[model samples]
Target: MKKQTINQKIEIHASAEKVWQVMWNNDSYKKWAAAFMPGSHYVGDLKPGGRIQFLDPSNNGMESDVESVTKNQEVTFRHLFELEAGNAGKTLGDMREKFELVEKDDVTTLFVSSDMPEEYFEEMNTATTSALQIIKEMSEQ
Candidate 1:
């Protein structure tokens, strides 16, 4: 099992607080993470040691453990799921998705970083990319 790290960034016009609000708020999970939440936005907690669960009607949901969290700064977590029924697939290990906020005069940079297994690293990449795109559009909206 090889470990891999992934990094992605997106500069938004809104503040970090604004982005975080839309990103973690369980109520708006469907608005942002709609790719995962196909039917509706389920309940979840965005706290350290908290559980971030996403439920979909089509059996495409995941539950993870909130390993650590830094308010308005970053959130680290681990994802556990069975690749195949009765068989523990590959644990993504620990995924530390850090959202670093920095203001450059007018534009605010939202840098995202994650560390996970190679197979699941692509999942983070795709999800992060989609999330950032939705965020940018939502910010404009």
Candidate 2:
């Protein structure tokens, strides 16, 4: 199936470096994504080609290999496993998510955009906002 994209933007009340620190910390993802699946972890390095997963954490996490990552700038990854048993039969494609952080007048704005499937639209949108909020809060903290 052809991939679809979803987009959201967030403004963080923190500096770009502070946001980068928390984002690449590698041990704090659980505090955010857990709200989506009850268990989520920092599964890989924060650099380009690093891997990560957002899963139940009860069963093993569904894996997604990072396609490209740029510190405090952008990150994109692909879903390795089929999202559902149904995706196994089709020409499944990659989902690309980018986080573009821009600073102006001492304010930071995070622009998030994703290429994903329709079914994932709602969840990703909600999660994206929540994740940004958490990151903003954590960065300011």
Candidate 3:
């Protein structure tokens, strides 16, 4: 079966740098990301080639490698595995997530795209929508 790619976007009336900060800063990230997993926060750096684990309060989460980072422009992460009960299970297929920012006329357009198996389409769609809404609110503040 072929996997699907989903794209979600929102325009924030803030600088790309500011949006990026709210999106990646651990505390702010946890707030918005709670839409997907309550108390979600990442445990790692945002530099390219670094390992990042997005975890919930119970520590259940997914681990990925930061494939690329371009400051306020873009960030790509490649899924490596899923952590459950403190055990890592190899990811069965390719799953790459990208966050891109385009600023024009003082408005920053943030786009989040992810590639994953079809089974996750709905869940991702809903989560991304909710997350982006929170991002919009935060950046507009």
Candidate 4:
């Protein structure tokens, strides 16, 4: 399946470390991730070569490999397949997601880039915008 990359960004009035914490901290992750799906969360490790599951309340979502991680700077995931009933399903069209943070003068710019099937471009783009807003709010507060 052909995929298109969706890019979204937000500038937060906070340090990169603060933004990173808000984005990855378990509790905060759920709060912002709700933009995509209520009760959305992740399981497993977040280091390079680790496997992580991005799951919804019903145990359905994506299983991805942690492609790279640079504390306070960047993280990337290569989504391998979908999950249904906590089981791996079909391949997800070589989709990948990356988050990069750059700080200047105490403000952080968070950039999110993700690839998905063309059919989902709009939905994912909107979700990502909302999610980034949530992250910015949480980090600033």
How many clashes show up per model?
Answer: 0, 1, 0, 0
RMSD of each: 3.5, 3.4, 1.3, 0.7
Task: Report the Cα lDDT for residue 131, model 4.
Answer: 94
Model 4 error, position 52 (Å): 0.5
Instruction: List where candidate 4 sits over 4 angstroms from the true fold.
Output: none
- Residue 136 lDDT (model 2): 79
Q: How does model 2 score by TM-score?
A: 0.77
Q: By summed lDDT, which 10 consecutive residues of candidate 4 come out lowest?
A: 87-96
Candidate 2 lDDT over 1-141, as tens digits, reads: 556687777787888767777766656666766555666654555556676654555544455677777666667767665433222323336656677788777678888787777887788778878887888788778
**Stretches of candidate 2 exceeding 4 Å from the true structure:** 83-92
Instruction: Put the candidates in lDDT order, highest first.
Output: 4, 3, 2, 1
TM-scores of the candidates are: 0.71, 0.77, 0.94, 0.98
Model 3 C-alpha lDDT per residue in residues 7-102, reported as the tens digit of each score: 888999999999999999888998999999887888998998899998888878889999999998999999887888547865736789999999
Q: Which residue segments of model 3 deviate by more than 4 Å?
A: none
Error of 3 at 32 (Å): 0.6
94-124 per-residue lDDT for model 1 (tens digits):
5445566666666667777766667776776
lDDT by residue for model 4 over 36-138, one digit each (tens)?
9999999999999999999999999999999999999999999999999899898996789999999999999999999998888999899998999899999
Highest lDDT: give the candidate number.
4
At residue 88, candidate 1 shows an lDDT of 45
Give me the overall lDDT of model 4. 0.94
